[model samples]
Structures are given as C-alpha cells and as structure tokens.
Target: MKYKKTILATTILSALLILIALGVSLVVSPMVERKAEQLLTRYAARVGAIERCSFSRVEFSPLSRSLTLHDVLVIYRSPKGLRKSMDRLEISVPLRAAACAVPSLRPYVLPENGSMDVCNSITADGVSFSMPGLLAGSLKHAAISGVSADARHVRAILDGRRPEPVDLLEHAVIDGLDAVNLRATVQTGTGSAACTLGAFRLRGLHDLGIEEIRFEQLNAATNKERAGIALFGMDGFRAPDAATLRLLLSVRLDGKKSPQALDKDIEHVLPMLQQWLTATIPPVRVLAVEKASFRGSRPQDVMSLDLMRLDWLSNRPREMKTAVKDLVLPAQLVESNGLHLPGLKELRFNGESDTRDEDGRIRETGYLSLARFGQLRYNASYAVPGGVFNFSLMQLLSMTIHDAAFSFVDQGALAYIALNQHDPDMAGPYFNQALDYSFPGRDNDALRAALKVFTDRPGTLDIVKTTSEPTPLLRCFDVATLGRLWRVSATPGKESLYDQMRRLAPAR
Candidate 1:
C-alpha cells in the first residue's frame, strides 16, 4: 500500500512540471515575435540609409528558431542619383542571424568565440529589382539560395571602409551562394547594350571559388547595326585577390568619375590604377573557358571559340602559358577584305612567357596556327641585367634585344602560288588569279628570291635576325637603326625557327 502511494505522488509531480513548461512557451512566443519584428524594422531602415522599406508580414517560428519575412519592398537612391526599387522580396534566416542583422541586438547575441556561425543557410525568393538612369534595367523573379556567412566577418566588413573590409574577407568564411536571373542594360557610345545572366554560384567569399557562372544572352545595338552573344560561361574560377573588389568600391565607382573628371583628377586617378596593375597575381593552377559564341551585326558574321586555357607554372621567373583551340573567325569579315576564302578555320594561338632567368633575361614565344593555312611562330629575347622591376631610365636604356625569329610552316598555303599562275589550257580560280594580279612587284630581286624559296615549296621558312651587338632599348625608336643593328637571314628548314636561329652565326 505504501509503494502504490509513492508512485501516485511521483506521477502528479511529473504532470505539474509538464504544465509549467507549456505555460512558459505559450507566454514567451508573442514577446519573441514582437521583438523580431522591431529588430527587422530597424535593420530595413538602416540598410544603405534606405528611403523606405515595407513588408506585409513578419513571421517567427520558435520551434525551428527561424524567421520568415514576406512581401517586402525597399527603395533607395544610388550613388549616381538614380532611384532603385526592390519589391516582392521574401527572406528567411535563423533567428540568431536575424538578431545579428540588427545593430542593437548584436551585442546581446554575439558569440564568445568571435566566430558567430549565423546559420546553416539563408534564402530569399521572388525578388524583383530595377535601376534607372543611363544604365537602367530590371531583373525578374530572381532568387538566392543557400547563402551563409559569419556574423563577425559581416560586422567587420560593414563597419569600415576600403582596405579594412577587403582585408577582413580573408577571415570572413562565407560560403554556398547560389543566385540567378541577373539582367542589366547600359548606355554605350553608339546605342545601348542589354545582357542577362542565367545563374551565378560561389563556394566561398574569401577564397572565392566560383562553381559555375553563365550569361544566357547578350544583345547590343548601335546606330549602324546590332550584335549578340548567344551564351558565355565559366566554371571553377578562382580570383587571385580581393583587389578587384576594393577597386570597384573606391572613388572610381562614382558616376562623376568620368573621363573628363578623371583627367582633372589625374594625380589621384593614376596612382590607384598603378597600384591595381602592380598587384600580385596569385598562382592559379589552371583556368579554362569551355566555349564562347558571338554573332556580329550581320547575319553571316559569326565567331566561335572552343576552348581557352591558362596555366601558371612558376612564380620566381613568373612563368605562364596560354592556349586557344578551334577559334573560327567570321566569313563576312574575311570576305569584306577581299580574301577569297570562306573564313579562317581552326585558328589557334599558343603563347608562353617567363621573366628574368639566371642571366637576367626575359623570353617570350608564341605561335598562331590555322588548320587550312599554316602556322606563324615568333620568338623574342631581351637582356635586363638591372632586374625586371628596375624601371629607371638608365636601367631601361641598359636593356638590350638579344635576338628574334619569325618562321612560317606551310601546311597548304604554298599551293596557292602555283594555282595563281595563269594557265592557257584552263581558267584559273578567281581568288588565285586576282591575288597574283593585285600583288605589286615592288620588291628587289634578292628579297623576292628569298621569299620565293618558301612560296615555291611546301616546307618551313625561317627569317632569323641576330644583333651584330646587343642593341640598346632606345634604338628601337628608329627603323634605320634596327636595320643596321640586326643581321637578317632567310632559309628553308625542317627544324624550328628558334633552333635555326640559335645555330646560325651572325652575318659579318
């Protein structure tokens, strides 16, 4: 009998505890809702000193610790004195993050660790925005999903100007941004251009690895004609640094910073530009663009690129290489120049450059290859004993051009010469006949004969020039000086042009 009585007493106590917990939740829910609304209202007002902000509902869910805002509207004036509007915006975020957005609430909710993991993610939907003035357009039904940020980093970025904000990005650790439906229009010298982006996504804020970003369409018009790009996209993009963002936020962003105003503010403008240019380029393992297509103002004018890739191999000598594949030029553009070819096909360019070597020499090499025609390769070497960055006038004058080479490897272009020679038995092709007739016979015999060796045969032709002595940089200003400085040699070869140049002795 005593055991039964003890059990009954414990059950009643447990029931009472449950009732008390329920009462507390019921009592606190309304207070939390009202507080959230008040904080958000203040935030809207403070954001960019907005002209106005309104919303239909402020919903807070205590169970999930999330806040949802509906039917929001914001109006603001841009730095250019243009008015902008965003309407029908819906936003959802964790309550803690929402609280952090409110300046007054920040102190109360800040984490002890200095890294406030605001939320797993935040989302906004049904966003529409418009900008008015010379550059004006509207974005329709845009959405942002899976955005997350560190509250402390946010504070650092929002609290200051310029370099501080950019520097803080290193520790910001924002990630997982997916945004879509970006559209814009801007005034151009001739007419206006309009562009639309299908999507943009990023993995992190500080490191800024772009997963995928693509522009769906671009339409540009001028007084004379219209052109457009069907599509352009990039994936796995890594920015070298935040300097680009810093420059955009600096004084250059103002609409008043036009060329005329820039000219007046030359002292200020030049230094900023120079600083940006000299900023270090981080070593990117590989950067690639898959494809790009452009349609010119005319229907027949189209250009397309298959692939482009860049690789940064080293930093000491700052070595890098770039290559393009299957680039096609417009047929109409070639025809306009009276070239009797459909177009240049499979045009490719590959280039490499490396900075100061052991002897303080810089070398650059490149080649242009055409599938139907041939390849044109060039090489240049320079000696800068003072160092690459030693740009003093004396250092520049001390620099010397060592040697240079230009070679053309014939794949099919040589056949045209024979076809151009008139035949009594048959009427030659129009392009070949016209080309032969139009080319003036102004060259001296030796020069013409030297060129004829390559024109007559299907092989590589090398034109290598070696300096009699290392030519000073300033001597390049005068053509006669270069002629006197360089001893030119032309020959047919199976070996590469640079190889031949290296083996050949300078003409006495």
Candidate 2:
C-alpha cells in the first residue's frame, strides 16, 4: 500500500509540472512577439513607414540565447505610390552579440549590447514590390547568411512580376556590391510613359555614410516605338570630388524629332542634366553606350533634353529611353560660363578621341568601329590669379587606316566673365558639340567661331597635326557664305523660326 501511494503522488507532481510549463510558454510567446513588434515598428518609424509590423509567432530560448521571429511581414510605402513588401521573414537574433552593426551617421538607438550593428542574421522567405494592382513583383528565399560589419553573403532567387504584364527577377546577389537582374514585360509604367527596358542587370556599391551610390548595368531594351538595344553596358562610380565614365552600348531608334524642337530644349535641359550629374559631389564615373542604329534622338537627348525633371538614373532612365525624333547626335551646347566653368573635366562619347591601344581595333565584335576605335579626351585647369582657364580637346578618327589618321589640338581660353555672382551653372570647359562626325566630314565653321568667342584667346591655340588629317573628314564649312545657303536649308516653320533667327542676327 505505501509503494502504490508514493507512485501516485509522483505522477500527480509530474503532470502539474507539465501544465505549468505549457502555461508559461503560452503567455511568454505573446509577450515576446509583442515586444518584437514594438521594437521593429519603432525602427521602421525611424527609417520609414511600416503599414503593419507583425509576426505570426516569436520564440525565445533562454538557454540558447536566441530569438526567432516567424512569418514576419514588412510593408513600405515609397513616395511614388509604390508599395514594397517583405514577407515570411525568419530572423534569428542570437542574443549573445552575434554580430556588431556598422556604425552609421544616421542616428540609431542601439540595443544595450555594446556594438552598434544590426542583428546577426536576417532571412526572408519572400520579398516583393507591388503597384496598386495587388500583385507586383517579388523574390523568393532572400537571405543574408554571414552578415557582419565588413562583409556578408547575400543571395536571392528572383521570381516576381513587375506592375507590367509579367516582370521577373532573374537573379540577385548582395555582397560587397549588390547586383540585381530584372526582366520587365511592360509597354510603359511610372515615368510619364517612358519606354521600358526588356531586361537589365544592375550592380551597385553604396556609400556607408550617405545615400550615395555607384552603379553599373548590362541592359537590353525593346520600346513601343519599334526601337531596341541588343546589348548595352554602362559602368560608373561617384565620390565627393570628381567622376569618370565610359559608354559602349548599341542602340536602334526611329525618325528623330526635328532639331528646332531639340534646339529649344537643349539650352535649358542640357545644363539641367549636367547639373543633375554634378549634383552628386565628390567623384563620379560612368561608362556609356558606343554603337547605335538610331532612327530618332539619342539617349543624351532624353536625358539632357526630355526627361530633365525626375531623379537621375534612379527613375530607371534606361526604361524611359525611346527612339524619338527629338534631338541630334553631336549637338552643340554653348558653354554658358566663359572660363569659370571648371567642373566638367572630361566628357566624351562616340566622338573622335585619343587613347592608347596596340591594334586600335576593339576586341568586341558587332560594335561601332569608328576607327581601330573612337577616342575622346579632355583636360582643363584654372588659375585663381591670372583669371585664365586652359582647356584641351583631342580626337582620333577610326576612318583612317590603322594609326594613320588623327586630329588633336590644345587651346587656352581666357575667362571673359568677371567673378560675377550671377553665372548660370556652366557646362564648363567644353563645347558640348565637338562638331566632329561619326562618319567623317564634320563642319568646324561655327564650332571654330564659338571656340573663338568662348574658348579661344585667338593667339593661345597650339594646333598640331599628330597624324594625317583626312581632307573631307575635318572639313570646315564656309560660315562666311552660310547665310546665302540658309535661304534654302533654313526655311521658316509654323512658329517662323527662320524669321526669328534673322531677328537675332546683326543688321547685315
């Protein structure tokens, strides 16, 4: 009888312990998740908005010193009416200071843990972007595996629909640099009916201190106007001081917009775009397109002339690129700032240029062979006391056999404008249109006069012929007789632009 009673009592005690443990867990789970929601929502508030910061469950293992949040959901409202979502976030924060956060200039309240870094590992089962359409686009199995201050492994499988017919995330990797491949099947979206790229891969490096970023792209596009780019690659870097970039893209556009339309906007939008570039201070480097079968305006026209209002590159300008008859290739931008325009040190694309290469032929096939290759080089200097600005432009034509043809000159232009307070942000140290031809025979008449007016001090130029100049290639138009020919070529339009031109002319 005594043994049986003892056994019964022990059984009752064990049952009681089990019930108590279950009750504690049931209560603590809510408390833990609630606290997590508060903390996460707080963070989102500091950074941006989170429509709802919640998780299906939260588990804390005291012995393991770990916190796991299950079925987490995060929603963000971008300014342009876009909603970004991250769902099924399984973040395991090992309470033992698993990793230290990289200190940021942005004010962030750190946890009691000594380090100022984010939690150790952040994993999300799915993340997506959506328009009002209810289903936008997403990535599956996105994660930051070995996250730390210096480096982390980021991987994501892209399988999502853009607001378009069917957009796709081809692939993505976020490591020292973040790379993403996006495929869009849309006629147009977001920006004022911009042309959308069929697919593109974007790689970016971020500035730890600010919202600065450097980007590169491997892109392909198909536009509504029956225009396309087979392959386009661009790479650029931006820092506080200066920037450099290159372009080697192949493009096809349609009937270009008349030059009158382009000429009007070029003056305003041209510098506006360059200003847009300079707005990002420190240093900037970019690589642009090289070849094209353009039916209409060049990409520079859309960037510098048409789409001047929106954010640069960020608004997905590549998608906005369309073949339209709005602007010209090698259009001229009169330097607004006579000598003080000092910022644009070097800017050249698809123009005569000089660069060192043994064969001059580009190894890449199916690209524009302007020569062995095209060359553009520029350098400028300023003297505070002498008030003089020296600038140089050099070009090399691929039309010449091997290394036989080249045209280069260095000229020192004196700053005509006083250190005046009101100087329209200048294009600086450059005649925007180098007046050289892609197929040789570019007129240097007006360009020479403009050079004389703004860039040349008359006696300061040192014209040197490094290689044989093809006679027809560097031909100068007889500006002295252009007025007589203008009667035929410069017919007045509905706005009577020819009349306006005569109005601005001297009383000859």
Candidate 3:
C-alpha cells in the first residue's frame, strides 16, 4: 500500500511540472510577439518619414508575430501649387525569427507585398507600384509587377521588373540584410518608360556589403512634357557602390526644328538677358556665348535648349544692379561655377523686328554651348525697338565702370571726381559740380605747374592749348574729364604736355 501511494504522488508531481512549463511558454510567446509589433511600428514610422510617406493603417497578429500595413500614401507639391498624392500602399512582414532571437527585446521586421498607387493626383488613369521582394529582412523575395504615373502633360503605360537586395547595417557592423526587386512603367501622354533590375542585395548591418546590384534596361519615355520643360529618354542609372551614383539622361523639345535655326534665335536675346542677369548676381563681369542649338516647332514657339556647358566665371552681376533691380539670369548660368569659367567660347544673337511688341520687347529662345575659357556659344533670338544686337567682348568694361562708380560714390569730392573722369556717362551732375566748387580760383598756370611735375610729355603746352575750351575766368571745369585727360597725357614723357594743358585752361 505505501509503494502504490508513492507512485501516485510522483505521477501527479510530473504532470503538474509539465503543465507549468507549457503555461510559461504560452505566456512568453505572446509577450515576445507584442514587443516585435511595437518595434516594427516604430521602424515603419521612421522609414515613412525618410521616404516622405505615411501609412493609413497597421495590423498586428500575435500568433504569427507578423504585421500587415496598408494604405501607404506619398505626397508631393509642385511649384505651381499643385498637390499630388500616391496612394493604396500595402506591405506585410514576418516577425517570427526576430521574435524568437530576442525574447526580451523587440525585433524589427520590414513589410512585404510592396505595392502602391502612382500619380493618383494628375491623371485620369491610376498608376501602380508593384514589387515582388521589396522588404528588407523579409521571408520571401519580391518584384514590382507594374507602375504607372503621369507622363508629359498626360498619362501613359509602363511595364518592366527589377530585383535588388540591399544591406542596411553593413557599414554599422550589425547583422542585417535587405533585398528589393522593382519593376514598373512610367506612363506619359505619348509613350512609356521601363526599368529592370538584375539584383540589389546587401548584407552586414553596420558595414554594408553589396553583392552584384545592377540596373538594366532602365529607360524613360522617348518624349514627355511638364510645365514648359520637355523630357526626352532616360538612358540608365547605376550605383555601383556607396561612393558613387551615376545616371544618363537625354531630352528633346515637343516639336522638331533645325539646330541652325535654334542657334540664330539665342543670339538675339542674350544682351537683355545679360542685363537682367547682372541685376541679380553682381560678381559676374563677362557673359560670352559658347555653343547653341535648338529643336521644335516655330508657330507655337516650342523648343529645347542647353546652356549648361557655357563658361560663366566672369559673368557675375554688378553690386549696383543687385541693390536697385530685381533680375533673373538663366538657370544654366546660375548653376555654373560663377568664379570659374572654362567652357564658354562665343555668344551669338538673332531676332525678328516684326515680332517686337509696341514697347520693343521680343520673345526668343535658343541653345548655348560652353566650350573653353569658360566661354559660351549661344544661339539667341528676340526683338527690340532698335533691332536685335549680338556682340562679344574680350572684357566687359561697362560692368567694371559701374562697379567703380558705386564703390567711390561715398568718398569726398576728390574720389568722386576721379571716378567720374573715368566714365562721365555714369557720373551724376552733383559730383561734377562738387569738383568745380572745390577748385575755384585755381588758375591754369598752377594746373600746368602740377601737370609738368607729374607728366613726361615734351609738347604738353601745345596739346593743352588745342584741347581746352574757352571759358569765363570764374567758369567751372569738368574735373572728371580733366583728370582723365591728365592721366592720358601724363604717360611717361607726356607729363609735361598734361601740365601745359592745365595751365592753358581757365580757372574755376
């Protein structure tokens, strides 16, 4: 009897222990799942922010330790105040491995079923983003099945597939992995663009290691339009490693036109453009055309041009212009290195008088080629009251003169007079008058004496007598002009001639 009782007690204790262990496993599993869900949610938020997107809803499953997110939306705003939205995004993630590995801490899991709406805001037909293996650290591989968006000013269809894997933590020395396959069509009003990927894979969390990631047959539409700019075809884009990113893009205008015709158009409009540009960026001194070409229709005035290759180093605007005027240089000029002009070579101008408005302003367009010495070859066209004028200068003197005038205007009479003498056209009358008042009663004899000492010319007296104008004894002289003349006469031996002229002139 005692033996039988002991056996029963042992059996009961074993059953109780087994039941307790089972309960613990059940409780721990659910807790782990909840932790994973929380971590994933946080990660999703971070990713969305970086991508400029948001998710409408997130669903979590405790039993499988998985998360399903849906209705991801991305938005963009155009310069014209138009808002665009991409919607209907869905993603799923498995947290089983992450949950089991870190029971006490939460694990991060990326979503699957990478799909989204494309260009929902601009076009009548909705676009899509389909990827088979889009999520990093997911259980299955994904690929983008289809993608569509507003192309040109209209909508078109796109079809292609690309698979890529990315490692997020390789550089950080963390154990992580990522892979993505994106295939889609970019739709436009007239045509389509396609992209295909071989593989994009990454491993090692902190120090990212990539394995054979490539983009193939990545092409855009043959034609498209947005705002006033035209887009040709996209050649291909590639990022071999973390250090470099490269892309090849080509584009043309909406219509067809000859390159020579385009060149002529740009030549006509460059001067006014230069003036306008100077008003904005003052450091630019010289704007020369490099090369120009054009394509498109004439009636609608639709065309495409390239000025990016022009030399722009000496083309900075003057400070005076900046303070007094609101000016706009071409986008190409602004983007170039204003301090270093190497590609510009020439500038050309052409235009039609008939096209000029009553105010003498004509519309024009053309191309520019920046060849060498930071020079630009431009083809321009426009209308002006006096007709179109296109000319190039080895140096831009007007800009220099303008700069000097503004810089010296704040100084006293002597400085102002000196500046005016260099360029009388730009000086104010007040400056001229001030100089006259300061030199009152100064006879030509004293002027001759001063000039004799500073100049080297032997026949200074003869030149002075010939150049001076008859005036009343108290009449004011143009100090600015006198100063400039003195400089010219004072060259080496000409100093004496300058002195003689000063003496022959009437006193102020």
CA deviation > 4 Å runs, candidate 3: 1-140, 143-170, 173-181, 187-191, 202-211, 214-508
Residues 119-199, candidate 1, lDDT per residue (tens digit)? 555566655555554676555555444454455566654454233666565445555565667667777766777766555
RMSD (Å) per prediction: 10.0, 20.0, 23.2
Q: Which rank order by TM-score, best down to worst?
A: 1, 2, 3
How well does each candidate superpose onto the true structure, as a TM-score? 0.60, 0.34, 0.22
Task: Point to the candidate with the largest TM-score.
Answer: 1
Please give, for residues 254-275, the per-residue lDDT of candidate 3 as tens digits: 4464776555545444444444
Which candidate number has the best lDDT? 1
Task: List, in order, the clash count of every candidate structure.
Answer: 0, 44, 102
- lDDT by candidate, in order shown: 0.55, 0.33, 0.30
- For candidate 2, the lDDT comes to 0.33
TM-score of 3: 0.22
Better lDDT candidate (1, 2): 1
